[model samples]
Target: MDPYLLSRAVSELGELLRVNSAMLVTAESCTGGLLASTLTDTPGSSDWFAGSVVAYSNSVKQNVLGVPESVLEQHGAVSEACVLAMADGVIRTLGADYSVAISGVAGPSGGSPDKPVGTVWMAWAWPGGSRARLYNFQGSRDQVKHQSVVAAINGLLGAVR
Candidate 1:
């Protein structure tokens, strides 16, 4: 990811959340802690940034974020069901007004017939509503992660409005 674009996204998201007095939590997998790190890059992010859970493993996803084992078994980690569960779980566990969850296969490997590399599943959840989307990006591992982070942040911005 370009440092400038990342900085811009973080700045924009920070301002929006600050104005709305909203708290956010993120559950990340393929992007690891990148999204969390990006958001925290902003000064005074503590106002609207609650915390993040890097649930890169299924055990952590289940134990920390409360993602159900059944969901993961049924839908895999990169499916809409799993992402939605992850988003809702993070909101419940972290006590954030909004939460975003990302799970993806961003690599030169892990490509199946149905799900190729760069296949990402992102979900956002608030008090009363939640939504998930599937995105297939084209690029290297770094690029896929970058695109996923941008999409996750942009989704939060849209949800605030």
Candidate 2:
């Protein structure tokens, strides 16, 4: 929850969206709507910020954002497959030029042998291509969520170039 870093992220996202003249949409899980909230916090955000879907539940991810049921079943919410689907789904569903998606277990609990707490998967999708990344951040739940949002914004900025 570093305000300075968050400010930089918001400024960078604003600049990127302004340069591209593109709209961005988000599909979020572990970070909830933090990514969306951060974008909308900027003034004149309506110029490029499209919308967001807080698809915290698998059913919402499948039904609202159009994430594939198979993807969810096979990879769960925090996997690369699911994050990619979420990114693509939000872009298509929201008619956005760029989209970012995130899912993770940001908690003191929910850690498994394979996926531990603070395990986050993020994806960015645009017209021609898409990419996803997995991060194992170390912190409290709030801190993990904050880091995920920062990463999501930075990933979106990176996606444009």
Q: Please, what are the lDDT tens digits per residue for candidate 1 over residues 1-161?
A: 57888788778878888898889999999999999988898898999999999999999999988888998898899999989989998988889899999999999898898899999999999878999999999999999998999999889888877
**Stretches of candidate 2 exceeding 4 Å from the true structure:** none
Model 2 error, position 137 (Å):
0.6
- TM-score (all chains, Cα) for each model: 0.94, 0.95
- Give per-residue CA lDDT, model 2, range 29-95, as digits (tens): 9988988988888888898888999999999999988888988888888899999999999988889
Error of 2 at 103 (Å): 0.2
lDDT of 1 at 7: 84
Clash pairs detected, candidate 2: none
Cα deviation of 106, candidate 2, in Å: 0.6
Error of 2 at 91 (Å): 0.7
TM-score of 1: 0.94
